[model samples]
Target: MNGIELIVIAIAMYAVAYKLYGNFLIKRLEVNNSNPTPSHTMNDGVDYCPAKPPVLLGHHFASIAGAGPIVGPVIAAGFGWVPVYLWILFGAVFIGGVHDFSSIISSVRHQSKSIGFIIQTYIGESGKKLFLLFSWATLILVIAVFTIIVADTFTHIPSSGTSSILFILLAIAFGLAIYRFKVSLTIGTIVGVILLFLCIFAGNYFPIQLNALTWQLILFAYIFLASVTPVWILLQPRDYLNSFFLYALMIGGLVGVFFAAPSINIPAFSSFSLDKVGYLFPALFVTVACGAISGFHSLVGSGTTAKQLDKESDARLVGYGGMLIEGLLAVLSLTAVASMVNKEFIDILVNKGPVPAFSLGVARFLNAIPFLNISSEAGQTFSALAVSAFALTSLDTAARLARFMFQEFFEVKENPEKESIFQNRFVATGITVAIGAALTFSGQTMSIWPVFGSANQLLAALALLALTAWIAYLRKGILFVMIPMLFMFAVTLTSLGMLVITNYNSENYTLSVISLLLFLLAVSLGFKTYNVLVNGKETSRELI
Candidate 1:
């Protein structure tokens, strides 16, 4: 198929899955409630209040659709478009969407709690501890890699400093407009997004230069403030606004691809091309997580999203449908990367990272469009900047999630007595900064990349098993969840084991060995979790 036709087919498949499989999951699971009581029903205008569907969607999509959708597809395209397309369609519809929907629905039935809590309740105490530890460690890796990614993008040229500053100011202004002025969130978001685009142009006009150390310090300060501030004031507004930029960039790339109508020059498959590094199976799974499936979505579904859900039925729309949209984005991104020539493709893979390479492909596609007159340099800059924006959005979400995990792990009760919510926000901010600092300082950080992909896929396999067990226990259809869960478990385990053996043979001794060991630990824990859930005595309260 041609580029545009391939994209259309993928999107149509996603729509069918959303309507048929998504609906079936909801019905079979009996997620409908006659008198639906979302966790946000008790929302005291704080963390647990009913947000409008649009605002809630904006928040959820922004949080979930991070650098993964961009980075993974581009990197995977190195193998070929066939694998990338197949994995995204199958993975997103069956695996990613299922994990997302189940998580949100499960959290709503309980209270708006973290997935760790749900695992603890349903899986067993040991399961809970293991999941939480893995979550914390994985999140740390996410924050580290994404932080460097953001830093790299923002510092690509001396001028990006202005764009960074402008974004921070716009976030603050957007926050105040909503919180203090009581403006409609949608209206505020529109203005904030417009201003963000203006800032991009402003970056070109009024460039700022700063030393790397100075830039790091400034970025740290901005993130600290952003984390501590109220969601309405900064977090929600910034993310909501940034979502528009992300969508625009994505849409623009898609339009460019279609208009250019670039031919797919790469072969459907390459002969076990091991020169790029990493095993194909695990690497493919890892690179395609957001497009296919991701454990992180479960956390988001349970953490903040379940609360805002106005109705149980909305889970299909917000969770499953939203994932389908992300899947489309992945397909579009992959197509853009695939359209590039082999030499240009390898150059991008080697020099500017996967995201930048993908952007370069998009730019090349856009340059082919009639009447656009986009320059190569300009397209490259736009691609880089757009990536920086999206990557930062992901980093922002990860920082918040990490903070939540840290607090939960410490068992810090949500007490109003010790400090105001804003004070607690400051604590969260501090934790985020500390995470960034540690990642920045550690010279051993690069090793995180090789194993991060598999580690994430491993987490997805574990979550699927846990969710499937819970559903079966709840008297839902076991066949659908069971067979798929087993398949994923086997695939992930085999892939992870291969990765370990490969790394061991390479003997580039570092913390990667630690990551391999963690994968093994996850496997053992998974078996134990399955055994306990199957044979253990039932309790009134679920325990992970």
Candidate 2:
């Protein structure tokens, strides 16, 4: 099939899932109810706050949909399009969307707490702590890896002085408009997006060019400040504005696929090869998680999303339906990579440059539009900037999440009780900045990417197991969850084991071995917790 056809198929699949499963099954299951109030109910008109549906959707989408969807598929195209396409559709509908929707619903029904808190209540405290620790460790890796990615993308741009200045100005204006002027979020976002595009255009007129090192330093500084600041002042406003970039990216990708009409020539299944950097089974599952399904989404779903859900009924559409849209994004990304000739695609991959390849593909579409001349170089630069924007947004979200995880882990109590909330927020932000700084200095962030896919997949497996056990305990069916959970667990464990052995032989094994061992330990704990749940033992809730 051609690229356009694949995109159409993906959209149709998502639409059907939204209608039949999201709307119908959600109502049938009686999952729509507004009883259990979210725990973090207090709102200060910013973070930890309730919001209207549109704004909440924007926030959720920006946080959950990141470079994962784009980068994963592009990387997976090394295997072929068929596996990428299949995994996205099936995984998004059955695994990813279900996990996201159920997590949000569970949180809403139990007071909007983090997933760890809810696990404590339903599974046991031990289970909760284990999950939280695993989650926290995973989040730190996420923040570290994404920070490096953004830095790399920014530094890759030809040192145009105008772009850097414009970006800083845009950020300042965006920060003030939302935090000081109290402008409507929607309006501020629109203005910020417009200004960002203008900066890109104005970049061409600048005589000054930035070097890679300078861009890196500047970006690190920006991240440091952004991490410590309040969400309203920077993170939220920036993410809100950046959503437009994601939208434009999606549009560009879709249009490219449609006009190019490139056919998928990769076989339905490639030889089972382990010699490649990323193998198929587990890697495919991990790489495609954000687009199809992600345990990370549960973090966002239970963390901030539950608090802002205006009504219980919105959960299906916002949670499940939204995931499907992300799945479509993955599909489009896959189509773009798949459409390229094998030799051309390999050259791009060998160059270690996704932006250039993506832009070249996009230029083909632009050229198809008569009189619209988009040079390959210009397209490449645009792609680079877009990618940089994507990486930055992901970094911000991941940093915030890491902060949340740290605070939850340390459980540092606030004095005078009333100050507890503020204390928690402050501590979390501090932790985020510290981690970001460490990662920037160490330069070990990219090393973590190889394991990122597996770690994330493992988290999803654990979450599904917990959710399934909870449902079964509540007299719901368990088989549906059990089958996939076991499959993913096996796949992830195998991959983790392979990574451990490879690292061990290389004589650089401390962190990798530790991570592998910890994952195994978690697996053991998860099984013990599962047995307790299934047997209906009089267990202390703290064991979770």
Candidate 3:
């Protein structure tokens, strides 16, 4: 198959799925916007604030998309593009879309609390505590690594550094105009988007060079403010604007594929070239989790998206639709590389990394434009800037989500007293980002990252369990939720088991022990979930 055919089929399938399967899932949730969302009912104007569908969708999409869809799909293409494509398509439409939509709706139904709190009500207090602790730790790791990554990118590509600083300023102004000055949405968006392009051009015209450490420090300060301030000020506008870069990139790739008509040069069904790539089953599933289904997406939904939801009905668009959009991006990423032969793809993969390979692929795509006479070098730079922007987006979003998790973990459940310091948003955000920054500068992110990599899919599996438990508690149809839940559990456990053995054999006892601990966490959660599914007649409200 050629890249054009893949793109066309993907677009059609995703559209149909959203119209048909998406509606079915929406009906299961019994979505009604009649009741005020937490954005209004629990509105504090900081975290809990309402947003229009476009704005929130942009925020949600940019937050979840990150460098993940680009990087994950590219590497998972090692298992072969055919398998990668199918998994992304099926996983997003079925497993990922359902997981994201269910999580958002469930959280919206429960006062826009984090999933950990939801698990507490349905599963047990112990479950909530464990999940939150695990999530918070993972998020800190995310914050640290991405901060380091974005900083490195900025140092290497000083133009992106210049663009990013201007980008943040532009987002803040856009947010202020829309929210504080009460500018109309249509006008604000027009101005914001036009200025966004200008910012990109400005970066290319006049680059600003800085050391990685300096860039990292600047990012730390930026994220600290991004986390503590109202979502309206920075998070919403920045992410909303950030989406345009990705949209443009995807469009360029698809158009290039259409015009270039590149055939799939990579072998199709080579899911397990054991010497080149590991076993296909669990490895591909976990590696490609971001574009398909991610446990982290659920956290973003419950932690931030839920709080900003304007209506119950918006969950379908922002949650399910967002995942499918990401699916397209995964497809685009796959197409970029799949168009190239195995030898050339592996050459760049080994020499530079997934990001560069993706960048080069996209460059080829855009350079296919004959009329415009675009250069591959320029296209690569454009793609790199977009990657850096999203990576920075993920870093800050992770910090804000971590702050939410940390505060929720510590807040008094039956509070009848004054708020504690830990519950204070400023204090919570400060501590969360601080620790993450410390880890990045201290050179400890690499070792702990492998642990999180293993735990990432495990997190998804546990989240699916929580969603399944919710379905069982409702006495509704469980097959849709149950099947995916089981598959993820098998994938996660198998991967973790492999890690345990692999690490133990290599005498990397720290990772081996940590992997074992996570293995146990998943097991405990499974038992609690089983009990809930079998005998969960009591209301979560009553349990609370």
Q: CA lDDT, every prediction?
A: 0.72, 0.68, 0.87
TM-scores of all candidate predictions against the true structure? 0.90, 0.87, 0.96
Local accuracy of candidate 3 as per-residue lDDT tens digits, 16-127? 9999998899777678889789999999989899999999999999999998899888988877888899999999999999999999988988899888988888898899
Candidate 2 lDDT for residue 530: 68
Q: What are the per-residue Cα lDDT tens digits for candidate 2 across 439-483?
A: 767877776667777778787777777666565555555555666
Question: Whole-model lDDT for model 3 versus the true structure?
Answer: 0.87
User: Which scores better on lDDT, 2 or 3?
Assistant: 3
Residue 279, candidate 2: alpha-carbon lDDT:
67
Which stretches of candidate 3 lie above 4 Å from their native place? 271-277, 416-418, 538-544
- Residue-pair clashes per candidate: 12, 17, 0
CA lDDT for candidate 1: 0.72
